[model samples]
Target: MQYYARIDRSCIRPAKDRQVTKRTAAEMDISSSIDNETTHKARSEGATRLNSLVASIYIFRLLFLAVCAAVRIQLDNGRYLVVFKGYPFYEKRAVRKGTAVICSCTRAQCNSYIHVDRDLNVVHEEIHHSHEPTRLIPLSNGRYCRSSNLPQMEFIEMANGKVCLYIDRYTFYQRSPRVWYCTNNVKCRSYTALSPDMRPLRMKIDHCHPPPKLLLNIFMTQRGKERLVYHDYTYYKQSRTRNGFRWGCTKNRWHRCKAYLHLADDLTIVRSNMEHTHSPHGTPLYK
Candidate 1:
C-alpha cells in the first residue's frame, strides 16, 4: 500500500511573475553600467582641465622670465640708467605729458633712443646702434658693472723692441698715438683707447679668435742691456752677422752651455740649437 502527497498550486510562483523578476534584474544592470560610464567621463574631463591649467601657468612663467631678461635697471653716478639688451640708455627727457620718458643711448656717438612708460614698458624705440653692445663684468659684491671702469691692461714687449697692448689675453698693436687695434684686425674688430698719460681709457668689441701663443720676448737687464728671452732661458747678443744677429745662452760663461740661435733682422727665428748642458732658469719672465 502507498500514500500520495498533494501539491498546493497557490504556493508556487507563475511563469509571468518569474519573467518580470528577471527583467527587473536586467534593468538594474543597465542602470549601473550607465552610472559607471558617466563617472569615467567626468574623470577624463577633469584631467584635461588640469593639464590645460598647468600649461597656462608654464607659459605665463616663461613670458615673465623673457620680460625680465629683456630689461634691466642700473644705478650709475647717482642716476638711474635703463639697460636693455646689454645697452645702457640715459633719461633724456619726459614726453606725453610726463607719462612717458625718452631715453637715449649712453654712448655719445650712438643715436638710438627709446620711449618708455612709467612702468618701464617700451612704447616706441629706435634700435639703430652705431657700435657694438656694451660689455659688463661681474664685481666682487655680486653686482655687474661696465668693463670700462676697470682698465687692467698689460704691456708686452716683443723680441723686436716693439710694445704691444695686452688685454683679456689678446694682443693689440698701436695704430695711432692714442689708439691700439687688435693684431688680428682682418677678422677681429677689437680695439683699445688710451688717455694722454698712456693709461687705458676704454676697450671696444670682443675678440673673435683665440689669444696668440707668444714664445719669445725681450727683457731689459739692470745694466741698461737687452736680453732675448726664450722658454726658461735668457740669451745674450753674441755676434752680428750680415743677415741677422746671433744669440748665445747666458749660461755659456758659467755652465759652458752651447744653446744658440740666429734671429733675422725682422726678429724672426732663423736657426736654433736649444740643447743645454744644465737645467733651465725656471723663471716665467725676466725682471
Candidate 2:
C-alpha cells in the first residue's frame, strides 16, 4: 500500500521571499530620534550573522531589521544598514542605483568588503586588506573602523542623532577647499552629498547627481591615458599623490553633464562639481 501526503507549496519558499510590510512614516516613532542604546556583543553578533545570511540570499525581499536602534533596509538596488548617529557607528542609506554595486576599497591594500544590490545579491566583492582592521574606538566620530591613511570625511553624531561632517587636521590640510563625497570608491553608482557646513545632505540637494561612473581598474590603467575633465581642464592621471587617489567623471558616463573629483586613500571622493540627471525622488538612476 502506498501512502500520499499533501504538501504545502510555501514551505520551501525562501526566507527572504516572505512579504515585508513597510511602516508608514507615521509608524516609526523614531523620526530624528537620538539612539542612546548600547548594542550588546550578542546583538552585534546577531547583526553580523544577519548581514552574512542576507548576503547569501539570491532573491531579496523588502526587509527591515532593527538591532539596537540600527535599521537595515533591503532595497531592490542594494542592502544598506543605518548606523544612526550618536552610536558607535554612523551609516546612512544608499539611494537606489542601477549599476552593479562593488566594494569601495580600491587600493591593492584593501580587500575585505562586499557590494550587494538592493535585492541583497552579491554583485561584486573582494578581500584585499593586508593589515588588521582598526579597533572600534568607543564613541569615535569616524564611520568605518580603519587604520586608514586616507584623507576622508569624518562625520560626528549629533545630539539629535543626525550627523555633521568632521575633517581632521590631516584631511582639512590635505584637501582644503574641496567638497567631500561619500562614495564607495569609483566602483559603485551611489553617492551622498554634504553641505558646506559639513552636513551630510541627501543626494537630492538641488538636483540629483548621478553616482560616480568608473571601476577600480582605472587605477591600473597601464597606458596612463585615462583622464577626467574638471573645470574644463582634463586631469586626474596622478596616483599615489595624496594620502589617497583621485579621479574625474568619465564625461558623465552615460549622461550629459560635467563633474569631476579627487578621492582620498580611504576611497571617498573629496571634491567634485555636483551635478546629476535626476531629482531626489528616491529612485534608482538605472535599473
Candidate 3:
C-alpha cells in the first residue's frame, strides 16, 4: 500500500531554471522594441500639430492688422462729414462784373449752397449794378490783372493742350490771391499778358526739340533687299531754286531741305523724297 508507481522523471522540469528564464528574456525584448516604435510615432504626430498651430497664429495676426486699417478710414470719413456740415449757408450777391463766389453744390438734389467771397471787394460801387463789365487784360509790364469786382478769368487752352492765365500786375492787391485767384480757381502756375500788338513773344509747340535721338542707322529696305546707300537733302524756295543742300557720307546722297529730309536715329539721312510729318495734322514751319 505504500508503494508509488514508477514516474517518468523527464516529464517534470524545474520552473525556476535557465530554460524558463531564457523564454522570459525573449518576450521582454519584443515588448521593449514595440514600446520604442510607439514612442517615435507619437513624437512625429506632435510635431505636425505644432506646425498647424503656428500657421494659425500668423494668419490671425494678419487679419487683426487689416481690421485696424479699416477702422481708421471710417473714423476719418466721419470727421470730414462733420466739417462739411458746419460751413455757413449762402447769402446772395448780384452776379455783376468782377464778382466771384464759390457757389455751393450745383446739383438739384442737394440743398447745400455757399457763396464764395471775392479776392477783393469793390470799395466805391453801387449796390444795384456795376458801371462797366470787368475786362481781363494784360498790363504793359507783362503781368495779368483782373479789374472787375467779380474778376472773371479762365485758363486759355492752347492747341497743344497746355493752359495759361492772364494775370496783370494789379493782382498783387488781393489779400488771398494765391488761394482765391486762378484761371477759374483751378490754380495757375504761369501767366501771360495780353499784348497790344497782338503778336506773341513765344508760342507753345506740341513737338519737343533738340530733336529725338536716332535709335538706329538708316537703311533702305525695298523688295526684301537692303543696300547701304548714302542720303542727300534738297531745299527749294518759291522760285523752285535750290537754296540749301547736304551730303550724306554713309548713304552717298545729297540732303536738300532740312524740313523735308528724313533722318535716322543717329541723325543721318534716311530718305530724301519722303516728307517729314508728325501725328494728326501736318504743321508747317511755325514762327
Candidate 4:
C-alpha cells in the first residue's frame, strides 16, 4: 500500500526534501497504475464468465396451459425461468388455480395479464410490451423451434369445426382474429373484432330496424305485414361434433332464413350464408 507523504519544513535540507518528495510521488504513480491494471483485469474476467454462462444456457419446456406455456433455462449451475419477452413472470406465490389476476411484464414493467378458469387464457393484455428480449438462442439441434425461427400463420381449430387465426400466444387472446358473419345480425356494417374477453359482441336493435341486409332481408310480407326474415347479427349454437359451439345466421332460429352454416369450434365459418330469404327484394311479386 502507498503511504501519505509527510515533509518536515524546519531544519530540512533543500536537496533532501526535493529528493524525498520526488521518490514519494513516483511511488504513488506506480501504485495507481498497478491498481488500475488489476481492476481492469478483474472486470474483463467477470465479463467473460457472464458471456460464457449466457452462451451455454439451454431452455427446456416445463408445462403448457390453454394459451400460455412455461419453460426453464439452465446454464452451468444456474437456472432461470424463460418467459415471453414482454410478459410478466408469475411466481408460484402469485399464481392461483382459477383467478383473474393482472401481471406486469417481469422485465419491461408494463401492462397486465388475466388468467381465467385456470386455463390462464389472456383475458386482457396491453398492446405494447416494453421488454424486447433476444428472440433466438441457437440450440444443439440445427432445426429447432424458437422465436427466432421464421414466423408462420397458426390456425387453432376446435372440435366444432370453427377455426381461429393466431400468430402466437404473445398477441394475447383478445387480439386473436375470429371469423364472424352478419347474416343474422342487425348491425351488418360492423367490423370483425373479438371482444376483450375473447367472446363475440352482440349489438341489440329494434326488430323493424333495417340491418343493411339487402340480400338476406328482402322485406317479406307476412300475412300482409312486412317483416324481416333474418336479423343482422350472426348466430351460434353448440356443435354436435366439436367441443365448442357452431356459428350460423341467427335467422336459423326462425327457420325463415333457410341459411346453412357449418361453423367450426375454432371460430371458422366452414359454410356461410346458406340461402336465406328467397325473395329478390320482397316476398310477393305482386303484393
Best lDDT goes to which candidate? 1
Q: What overall lDDT, based on C-alpha atoms, would model 1 receive against the true structure?
A: 0.75
Q: Which tens-of-lDDT digit does each residue in 119-232 have in candidate 2?
A: 545444444556543322111122332224222334333334443332221111112233333323243232334446543333211113443322332221223355432222
Which stretches in model 4 have alpha-carbon errors above 4 Å?
1-24, 27-34, 44-48, 51-287
lDDT values for all models: 0.75, 0.38, 0.34, 0.41
lDDT of 1 by residue, 126-154 (tens): 88998988766443233455767653455
Flag regions of model 2 displaced more than 4 Å.
Answer: 1-99, 106-108, 111-113, 119-121, 138-287
lDDT of 4 by residue, 193-227 (tens): 33454332331112233333322221212133222
- Candidate 3, residues 225-276, lDDT tens digits: the string is 2212222211221111133233222211222223444444354555554443
Q: Give lDDT for model 4.
A: 0.41
Q: How many residue pairs clash in each candidate?
A: 0, 14, 33, 21
Top-scoring candidate (TM-score)? 1
Off by over 4 Å in 3: 1-16, 69-287
Range of the 10 consecutive residues with the lowest summed lDDT in candidate 4? 166-175
